[model samples]
Target: MATVSMSVNGKLVSRDIDPRTLLVDFLREHLRLTGTHVGCDTTQCGCCTVHVDGKAMKSCTLLAIGLEGAQITTIEGLAKGQELHPMQAAFREHHGLQCGFCTPGMIMAAVDMVNRKGNHLDDQTIREELEGNICRCTGYHNIVKAIHSGAEAMGAAK
Candidate 1:
């Protein structure tokens, strides 16, 4: 076991965990932040995506022990009080989710994309960028729309 210290969702946390524990497991099992899903243990699935130091990362691909002192943000951290984040609101408004299993990761990835790409994300670019995030339902039509609108909203918010 190794001692790991990190900031999660604006809260400072330190824990003793197995050296090989994945970030997703650390978040879900240790911190009880189950919002970060584990759709696939492999990095191919984006269901385990989260923001680490303002950048999107596959939590399953990183070991918790290797991320000491890093700042992580899960889907649960995106909202403030009762208000939803712009990307989340856009997804809800556009009906971007169907089964909802991938919603959290999708939202996190979209937020990070918009944050990096700014508000000019076109449909083609959005679709291309979201290739990593697979949604078995919805065919990604509404997801693209939501990202478009969400990108605009995010820019406006800033």
Candidate 2:
């Protein structure tokens, strides 16, 4: 087992895991951070998306040991002082979810999009950027609206 240390959900975490263990498995199984879902064994599903060093990344596509010392943020990290992040609030406000299985990843991706795109965002661009995130329940209409409105809300705070 390899010892890896990283910051998760604003907490410093260290664990001994297999070198080949995927970040998703480490988070879900070892760290008990089940907020990051596993939709497909393949990396195509954005359900395993998380923030590594403030950038959105697919946890399934990454090795746990490779992110040593990195600051990681999962859906559980989005809330601060019992307040939901703007993206999460937008998701709830816009009804961006249905079954809720994809909500975590969708929120993470939308947060990344808002942070990256800022106030200069468009519907088409948002849609194009969210291609990797698949939400089978909501038909994406509400998701796009959430992202657009979420971006505006976060930008306003900035």
Q: Which candidate leads the pack in lDDT?
A: 1
Candidate 1 lDDT trough over 10 residues, lowest sum: 111-120
TM-score, model 2 to reference: 0.96
TM-score attained by model 1:
0.98
Residues 69-112, model 2: lDDT tens digits: 99999999988878988888989999998998888988898889
Against the hidden true structure, what lDDT does model 1 obtain? 0.93
Top TM-score: which candidate number?
Answer: 1
- How high is the lDDT of residue 66 in model 1? 91
Q: Which tens-of-lDDT digit does each residue in 1-158 have in candidate 1?
A: 88999999999999999998999999999999999999988897799999999999999999999998999999999899899998999999999999999999899999988878889799999988897898999999999999999999988988
Q: Could you estimate the TM-score for every candidate? A: 0.98, 0.96
User: Taking the candidates one at a time, how many backbone clashes does each contain?
Assistant: 0, 0
lDDT agreement of model 2 with the native = 0.90
